[model samples]
Target: MQIFKKFSQLSIFYSEYVSFPYPHATTVKKAHKCTINHCLLHSHLVSSHASHKFVSSGGKPAGGEGDGAGAEMVGPQRPQFVLFGSSIVQLSYANGGWGAILSDVYARKADIVLRGYYGWNSRRAVQVLHQVFPKDAATQPSLVIVYFGGNDSMGPHSSGLGPHVPLPEYIEHMRSIAVHLQSLSDTTRVIFLSCPPVNEAKVREGVSGIFSELVRTNELCRQYSEACIELCQEVGVKVVDLWTAFQKRDDWLTACFTDGVHLSAEGSEIVVEEILKVLKGAEWEPSLHWKSMLTEFGDDSPYDLVAFDGKTTLNPSDWTFHRAIQWD
Candidate 1:
């Protein structure tokens, strides 16, 4: 009852008031907002535990017996699918961010781990890969999606010259990442999302003052996108050519981008579609919908119980959510 109430409250909060801010906004501001939201969610989780009186396997009150002892088996652990990149990826959880869409589609199928940073380039990404994807199998992801190059393609003379990772170095960094990911798990698939084209005209026209003078142009972004495609090809990984995809559309500037850099909801939809295509090609499908387990009003039988920890039980009360329910 406590868990149900907690989820119900969260659901109401998100449906009524939650909204991720624009991606191109300052990182400090965005992060501050997210921090507040996280703190609230963490408090909710903690409070839920206090109210949840777990029943042990022997039908005894958990931690309510002698010595305040109790057994806790935090249910299942699902396959992890991680997204690693810069602000573009980081903003995916925003209203129109592709990452958010992916999270919705894969709600119970996989745990979507977001490792997106505000201004990270492939160089910075490479440095953090090991920390994000530890060698431990338990922590390693089943799928890794890498989206970078927006910051890497910035002109050397731009506001922060240090962010510009050279073309050759960019390509190499991508290659190294692919190799490292493959080494972690043979089954782990990697996909690279090439940078989308930037509209310099739009940026200069006072659309987004943040990147108005940033040295990133459509031409420069094209080069990085091509390099990403080539690197993926050479490494036998999948590549999504977002640059080409956006350019093929008319009025991409207004339709795809909120700012000159971050994607709008329309752009996010396109990204979600492209990623789904790749997933389909690999024969990936959504996990069984949770609703399937619900009994109808006239139903006389209970749903079969299954455990993610490789165990089977007839009691639905025994199921806990340690991990997510994954697609078969």
Candidate 2:
């Protein structure tokens, strides 16, 4: 299917394969030092409609189906969940990146739509909120995991040019985003990830290589994180307190972050745990947990291992991923 035109305009590079050139580094520390692989392969170049022809409820082809053409109720639509935020979200598919982890867990449960922009902050996020979560969406995302404020909480560069959004404005922007996402659909749910703490030493060590004149301090990040938590509590939105969670781990300072800011694989694991905890504990109806969700398509009944008896007795084995047959 053709991607929404507006969404196409926003995303220049869609999806890609990730492979690192670590040269068989032996130590975990050496692997951590390896640069993040960016061998991006654009997966959206091919049109989804090239193979299948979807017709509207009116029996017309999908392109110009016009009104009331809600596919499935109008072609088949898969359940969708969105991950929207800044670099933390954009680079999620990286090796062991948190977004990649969620994609793996929810592989057959739901489609994970990634909407991340590198170096973007709450200020910029608010400006493009509509395009990301359009009002005319045929089906809204069941869940949206939001991450921002890391850049927003930065100590402004001396040149006065950066993604630093004032704390009060940041809070308001986040609140607005939450409201807009919640308003998208009654089924839409939002989870905010508070900004995580940064290692001041590492930020000074390597951040300049990425963004000269960039400044970040744990103190600043903590304040922003506190603000996000407070905002989530006030608005009755679910949140993953990344700042506190990272701190709770004894090795977070050295283990959780790759360059004092971005998440390391270890850090991403923490994110996965936190997000799963929220999904399992939230009071949302019709839970979206991978274990709880029914896999798409029916069971692999045809592949079930049958007994080699001459008689046609039905003896299925679990080796073929066939759950116990319910005798209704």
Best by lDDT: 2
Off-target runs (Cα >4 Å) in candidate 1 are 1-75, 158-160, 205-213, 283-328
Model 2 residue runs over 4 Å out of place are 1-75, 209-212, 305-328
Q: Over all chains combined, what TM-score does candidate 2 have? A: 0.70
Residues 17-51, model 1: lDDT tens digits = 21212111111111122223223331111121222
**What TM-score should be assigned to candidate 1?**
0.63
Candidate 1 colliding pairs, count: 1
The worst-scoring run of ten residues by lDDT in candidate 2 lies at 319-328
Q: Best candidate per TM-score, number?
A: 2
Measured with C-alpha atoms, the lDDT of residue 258 in candidate 1 is 81
Each prediction's whole-model lDDT (CA): 0.64, 0.69
RMSD of 1: 12.9
Backbone clashes, each candidate: 1, 4
Cα lDDT for residue 195, model 2?
87
